[model samples]
Target: MKLAYIVALAAGLAAVAPASAETLLRIGYPGTGLDDRPFGYGDYIAIGHVKQLVEAEFKDQPDVKVTWTFFRGAGPALNESLAAGQLDFAAGLGDLPAIVGRSRGLATEFLASAGSHDPLYLAVPPNSSIHSVEDLRDHKVAQFRGTNLQIATDRVLEAHGLSEKNIRFVSLDSNAATAALVSGNVDASFGGSEYLDLAKHGVVKIIYSTKNDNPTLGRNSGLYVTADFEKAHPDYTAKVVEAFVKAAHFGADEANRQDVFEIWAKSGLPAESFATDFKDERLAHRLSPVVDDYIVARYKDQAERAKAYGLIKKDVDIDSWFNTKYLKQALTDQKLEHYWPTFDAKGQKLTDGEVEQTRAATN
Candidate 1:
């Protein structure tokens, strides 16, 4: 009986082994930590990922197979995969790395903003003498380079009348940075809300956070799809964006605040950490998926700054890189045109009247 069952199983495997008619859709995201956590947070994509919305969208198509990949090396690793033509789409990519990749001639289109105004936290050893941003001068600081965090760190330093030259910048990823901080090997490290859990345990003290500071000092990340995939499968592209837009609506609803955090907790971050990081901020502000004027301007500024900082060799034409047709169509189809507020180039919220006018004009 065992031998017969084995033979049947083998036959079944062989039947599906030749999947010549299958279409594989590959999605990539930069993952942090040494454990290579299979999830992510701080955006509507987290909610979408946890809910498996993308998979559900294509469930009826038996020929389609969707796969998600998380790289432990972070944004740079995502770029490497893109260069190798491995990913069809990449969500939750930071502005800086995206710009670097585009400058390097990666043929892609910015689909939608995944999350914006994500605060940056500067952590120091407990009982350290650093009292403010100015105190960072001449101190050994650990920062994750080639990611969105790098630009935010530079913006914060510039705000405090300091630059990268003012401190000893040590390049380290999240896990290494945390380990160095705990061992007193680095005076401070700039990172995301994951540090809050450490602060809760008295493992590190947060000296500065940009949650309530200048919004521009905060980081922005978004979704992107390769031009090749988008051109080849426009229908799949539309369906994927619509799925994410649906998830964004759910995440942005005030009534779903607790539910949103619970979903994000799947990323291995405590729910309370997200709660603390977004304490005063509204979900609608952070979770909007629209590629609005402010987001475009921010990308332009990031590109110019990246060029000035020698992070990229040449200019990236932001206007030509963004393709918002899918996002617009998704919003219109979902009847969510005016659901989220729009901000100006300076990050100030537009008045209701202005928002209405913009919506009308777009329609």
Candidate 2:
């Protein structure tokens, strides 16, 4: 009877092995220290809480384990990790990496926006008189290549009839670029809402918003997954989306405003000014698994623009480039049923209770 029981247990274990064998939650995000400190390399993993959230969602499931890696900045570290197969999914990718990844057969898939809620803006030194992309010609510019921010930068330049050759492009990371601009190393750099912190300190000011150039700049900064782990363990990808959706909601809270500041502050981020004035749902959530129709149309249009402007290998169908299947599935399974309602950035409000209520209702 004991032998029979052992054999039955062996059969049960075998049944579980296959599913568990291919499961790993290898998420990638900006590198930072624990408690959200920056200089993520050799120290902390940015967006680490996503791991905690995913684990909580599958706490009792023995087959799942989470491992997160950080790319020092969005451009180099993120791109390298994905290229090396050390990363299964990552965020902070620019249009170049996404386009180059597909061109180079990197087996990557565009996932969703980092905020899907909103995007960063083009910024310059607070004291600088420059106000438009057209003004940057013959001046030095700082950027981290392979970032979506670069896409924004390019678009801003193109609108003003400028190209890479028209300006001096200096490669620099976010922190480095910010420091460079402050010290006058470069005339200007692409700024996000994060730049508000420096602007408050009187070091920088937004020259223009990417929103001023294209509304879909929101699609420029986003999260994406590699084809390997995504195909091998699709369910795990779904779990990742669910976790981000949760974080996005959590980030929307006015109560978490301080906590959010602390998170970035820990990472040496300067979100203080932005957070201080950030009182809108626009920056809070972009919970859509479906591409906006305008953005969908622009997929191909942007590719053509990239090619015409000499930014990509060739014009590729943007629809073919995106893979939102997991996001759609995650939204369905998590029972998330609403798209982020459009908000007026100019006249936004935040009710803490409303934030909690909406978060609870959605997630």
Candidate 3:
């Protein structure tokens, strides 16, 4: 009878062990990983990393483990991991590649808009005679083909009545393009805030930027989770969103602006670079997670543009691509429902009721 009791206790212990096993939450970000610091470009996820927000969210559940992987290959490489079921969540995915991934049948749901209306600039050799976008006709222009920078470059060219056909397009990553620009290997290159440093040092000259131009020409980024993960762990997904929203709240506050700039400077760029890039731009507007009419219209337009540019083979249904349930619940749970303003499709502010109507339609 004692032996029978011992066997039964062993079985009960085995069952309880499985329940206490660790649950791994794998997250991916498309940026160069810095030792002892997460990639910080005024993004909420980066802030979350600094503050241990996600880990804090799961602190009560000791069996949960949150792991993050940074990819230097950017969105395309991150998508490959997502496709292989290696990543449960991904952030900093630009408009074009995210659309391409969805069009190719990757089962991921958009969680929230990361950053939008980020200006892109065209940089040429400091000594070069290229003074404007129109001067690049028949010249070699280095562009990163598979990223949102490609779309920004295309739109800038179109705005100047020029196309890729007008230039000899060279495919290169941002670092490579920057090197090429400094060495005069490419007549000009298009990129983001890094170019500000190059210009400051006389290595490159900024000919044009999308700051006050067509907002569509600028870049937008977002965060996403695998559909399977979201479906299987809705409560966990909610917690993740809550953590990110909490970070967003901190990132958007005016009091944290200086600290954000200082933290992001750890990515090897000077604090002045972030300040110059974000000049005259509201931090809250850039870091907002709200899926308003502007977010929907911008992504829908990106899909149509990508299709027109022959970048993607099929149309992407932007409406079904998003899972706003998590974000809505996060806002309510965090009491940040009215923290950020809503914008229309044209980037204009909307009344509170209009914002509610938009949220209602999505819900």
Q: Pick the candidate with the highest TM-score.
A: 1
Q: Model 3, 164: alpha-carbon shift in Å?
A: 1.6
252 Cα displacement, candidate 3 (Å): 1.1
Per-candidate TM vs. native?
Answer: 0.91, 0.75, 0.89
Candidate 3 lDDT score relative to the true structure: 0.83
CA lDDT scores, all candidates in order: 0.88, 0.60, 0.83
Q: Lowest summed-lDDT stretch of 10 residues in model 3?
A: 351-360
| lDDT of each residue in 113-228, candidate 2, tens digit only | 55443455567877787888788888998877666566656766676788788989998877788788889899988755557767767778876765544554543445678877
**How far off is residue 77 in model 2, in Å?**
3.3
lDDT of 1 at 131: 85
- Candidate 2 — worst ten consecutive residues by lDDT sum? 39-48
Candidate 1 residue-wise lDDT, 1-363, digit = tens: 999999999999989797667889899988743366788887888788889999999999979898999887788999999999999998999999999999999999999998888889999998999989999999999999999999989999999999999999999988888889999999999999889999999999998988767877788998999999999999999989999999998888766888998887887788898889878777888898977778988899999999999999898899998888999999999898888888888888874432345445776
Per-candidate total of colliding backbone pairs: 0, 11, 0
Return whichever of 1 and 2 wins on TM-score. 1
Candidate 1 least-lDDT 10 residues: 351-360
Full ranking by TM-score: 1, 3, 2
Residue 309 local lDDT, model 3: 91
